[model samples]
Target: MTSMNHNQRRGRVVIGVDTHKHIHVAVALDDFGGVLGKEKFTADTAGYGQLIDWSMTHGHLLTFAIEGTGSYGAGLTAAVRRRDIGVVEVMRTDRRDRRLRGKSDFLDAENAARAVLAGHADAVPKTADGLVEMIRTIKVAKDVAVKARTSAMISLKAVLVNAPAPLREQLQPLSKMALIHRCAGLRPGSMTTVEAATKHTLRSIARRWEQLNDEITAHEKMLAELTTTLAPQLCAAFGVGADTAAEMLIVAGDNPERVRSEPAWARLCGVAPIPASSGMTTRHRLNRGGHRQANAALYRTVIVRMQHHEPTKSYVARRTAEGKTKAEIIRCLKRLLAREIWSLMRPLRINPQTVESAA
Candidate 1:
């Protein structure tokens, strides 16, 4: 009996972690669904070590089911991954369950462990330590800069609208680029009059727009180079440019295998049709879930294809002739694009094992 009990103690264990900004709560459970221990640790390198040591005391560590692997739990996830342990990203527990069972950090952690044991949460989080991550970071800056540049342009135009008659007439006659150039060259000597104040505002805004434009151009060039290097085939594919390709890559993360299949890819991009069938009314509607940015990317690609690509044009024509509405046709085309993208990207996936070893 003692030997059997000892063997039971040696069985594999699962650790669930509810992560936060300053601390992480963990629960250890044996393979047989028995809770072995609960602990809390600081959200840092030293704390991660302590958590791992405490979990190991229960039994052999099998996997960690963690909440917010992309956010709060990211550090701990990376640490566990560095040791080559499996990690599963646990989604938020069902609100209904939480309402019934009540809520606490410890309970949340336990639920995460049980979720893995029950085979509910199986998502592999993105390994945000690669070229894709670099692309994402740069793209973030580029997108914000683009928005700021647009705002500056708008503000420049708005100021011109209310400027003194001579100034308004002078600037309004120019094209957008010409107006920007003229405004940027304006020399406001003093704030003595309305004209000078108007000139000052226009010049400042135009210069800001120019700076942001330069920054955006630089970011786009870097993105083009990195995305092309990472997935030459994807970049070379129809209807995909640097921005769109970056969006798709960000959606897939550095680990493309996490997507599993083409259908999964479509679902991730929110292009997969969702069934809204009821009894005799069998039909699928456009899915409204998944990554919105990816969905927009797919939409942009399809629009480009609809206008330019010969094969896609022909397909659209055929579908249109068959009584399919433009929306339905576009939906189908997005799914097809997702499939093609998945195939093009699969071969380019960097091996996680190779990445781990290099780390």
Candidate 2:
């Protein structure tokens, strides 16, 4: 089975990897997207070695594109890169779009491989041993914490809704520090003992929410450390704190060279607008393409910039006077911020202000 999979006659091979948590499937395709060989294996050392060996025996593994490199895709990409194997991280096919045709792991893997071979898929490979993956993991943690915090808030609000006005007043400050204290005794006076017992269950939920707050803070500190160490250069600027810098740097991936243009970064963040034209009209709107997570991080930075500092305030006011709406102005500012970010992250040339001075 391994030999059949390892056949050198697989033609010029472009590999597509369908990534999941426990297992990964890789298919080698010829130039015409014909499947030369396909194998399903666990995403462990033995599995990685088998896949690499298969590719090396065939033509050089020209490009390996995997979907969602930041999630389940991380382990596979890291494994491949460790073997000096080149990887192309493809975006996942939209489930709705995929369903329009059909849905299966086989189809997903084929679409990914075909995307790479057809020149339709271009993924920015991470550099410095996939540090972007590590930073991206922190983002996952941050998001989890956010959800936990939100759940806690929702529970608090539920309590407020059910409690009498007096009880609400007691808990209102908790809206501010509500998640800080334990919710062991929270109960509505109107409820019977049974109802009270169930209501108190919400207190347990609130306690869990408090734990999430601590976790969120801890993950944020770890994210800060990533910037402080791997990308201290990114954090050197005003308004670009550890979280902002780390998010930017992570999506930038250590391989800044893979992103050839500032517009590429902007597009990846979905902050750059697309030009839509009719027979006689030409207008640009917010880019509907690229990674939404990266776009969101940049959007948050824009909000932070507008509210936090002088230059950002002046820029917003100036753009507003020039007749741009709030949405239009934000889009413009995000692009500008993208350019500044690209300059600071000049992959080929290190600015003295970045890693050097910090070092």
Candidate 3:
């Protein structure tokens, strides 16, 4: 990979980055879309620094436009933010079809840079390796534990379905303890040929599941510690539980400043609908934009809150009486919830003198 240095102090240049797991391709363009340099670099610290040195040596690097900020772009974004470099996230290939033709590492990088110059693709990027990553790791581990517990219960019930009536009755109330003890004592050689084989496999699974639960509890403790040290604003909000708050913070990329407005946040979560107006019918349909996983987090949240939150529940009931379907009502709730979250969260942004204030 050739390292570039911007020896010429040209006007603002646009950088397009095509990212992969270990390598990233970047292309630089002068103010007029003239290709200045293109090269491959390792995604690590040394590589990005060389890219930076190249940019500065040639001229001022205006910004980086990259496709898909949530995945391969994540490492790159984290890398850039650590350097305080300006990077913009471009919508994926679906944003335009023409650019999709003749795609390659070099071409994709060029398109990313061109998109910056053309002003067609861009977003204020959030950090990749900040509190967001910490939150996500904790949440995933907890989810694994919860799933394991659920699976254990399900498997126990399945075993009961075929169990002898007297045995089932004896184990009914003592199910948890009985299952745990039996599973703990089970080994490959403990039973007859067939019985031992089945018991050994199932018991191994149970033991592994129990171990996973222990890991989950440890993660929970870590999560509790981080809740106070970081993401305090999210933790302080009503209806935002630990896992939910952690997910939302990660989705927002830890820096609420780039989230901008309620609509922006909603759109980022794929909850806000795109505007579609026909001659006679003008209504907003759901938008599948931005992060679907984050949108699902909000969806799960509102459902839990709708059962207990009087104001939000009443709002849904009122809208329901107006003949809105359950799905429609849920959609409306998602948007409103996005707005509320944005309002509660905007004050927590790390930036100062921010523009484009939204209600």
Candidate 4:
């Protein structure tokens, strides 16, 4: 039988990483929170291997505390976990701490390790290697297309407002779609005159809008298909559509098990009620923090249920009869929806260990 090495015999160690575009700063610490070593490595596969090997020299690497796990640190986090090491998502160092202790990449990396050791940062980073990632990418494209289309429409209208009287008269009375079709069909033979210039610009903007519409449609179709495939139960749930399901999935991340619980999921979506108690007054208020997009998805789900679901309508009516305000009712509905969505998403959960192994 092979004998255990010194580093291997050591109980456990933690590594903290401060990641950047081209480089990463790492700090290693023992179980008792003593610094082992610090090093800088290139932000690449080779560098990841070197960093892991170096950390293992100090002790058994039990976990990594990483900052910006969704952005700059994502690659490093993925790389480390691929070796079956645990990774915790660490928030950036508090500004107050930076002011008092000063700031440097090495210091930040050390702080990350200390935070994890102190039990201050315990959340697992998302595994962005699955269908949820694909949906997020598609949603981003769709968002840009929608924004561009709106801008094109606004510009088209603004130009018409100042266009030549004859051209304005010719286009102003048309409906929005009709105006776009007409402008796109315009034959601007000459750009030498102001009227011709107006026609040319309008035609360009209208055509761009049409193209964006097509792009958005394609993205939506793709999103619907992907969301359904990823979470059919979520997609089939009352008041949950492709867009809402996609947003929820993105917020929960590719590995839903990292969410911990339904309340944690609600907090992530900004639907968790925050306690606002005073000496003689005990009350909870709406949470304004968390992912706004996810909150909006929950709101949209509530709206759909309010409008069409019989049981939801009854609940609303009963709440109103008991003197609850519409906003309060909506808040309650959102919390309920959050719980429902979390339950549905749980079945699709991927074990965090599986994520690390598959990384």
Q: Of models 1 and 4, which has the larger TM-score? A: 4
lDDT of each: 0.89, 0.73, 0.72, 0.89
RMSD (Å) per prediction: 2.6, 5.1, 5.5, 3.1
lDDT of 2 at 47: 78
lDDT of 4 by residue, 1-359 (tens): 33347677777788999999999999998989888899999989899899888877787757899999999988888888899989999999999999999999999999999999999999988889887888899999999999999999999999999999999999999999999999999988867899999999999999999999999999999999988877888999998888999999889888888888888888999999999999999999889999999999889889999999999999999999999999999999999999998888877774322323433
Measured with C-alpha atoms, the lDDT of residue 259 in candidate 2 is 79
Rank order (by TM-score, best first)? 4, 1, 3, 2
**Candidate 3, which segments miss by more than 4 Å at Cα?**
1-9, 68-84, 95-100, 144-182, 185-191, 228-233, 236-238, 350-359
Writing each residue's lDDT as its tens digit, candidate 3 over 162-243 gives: 5556545644566675676666566657566655555665576567667777787788787766654565666776677766
TM per candidate comes to 0.92, 0.77, 0.80, 0.93
Residue 65 displacement in candidate 1 (angstroms): 0.7
Residue pairs with colliding backbones in model 4 are none
Worst 10 residues of 3 by lDDT: 350-359
Model 2 residue pairs with clashes: 174-178
User: Which of 2 and 4 is the better model by TM-score?
Assistant: 4
Clashes of 3: 6
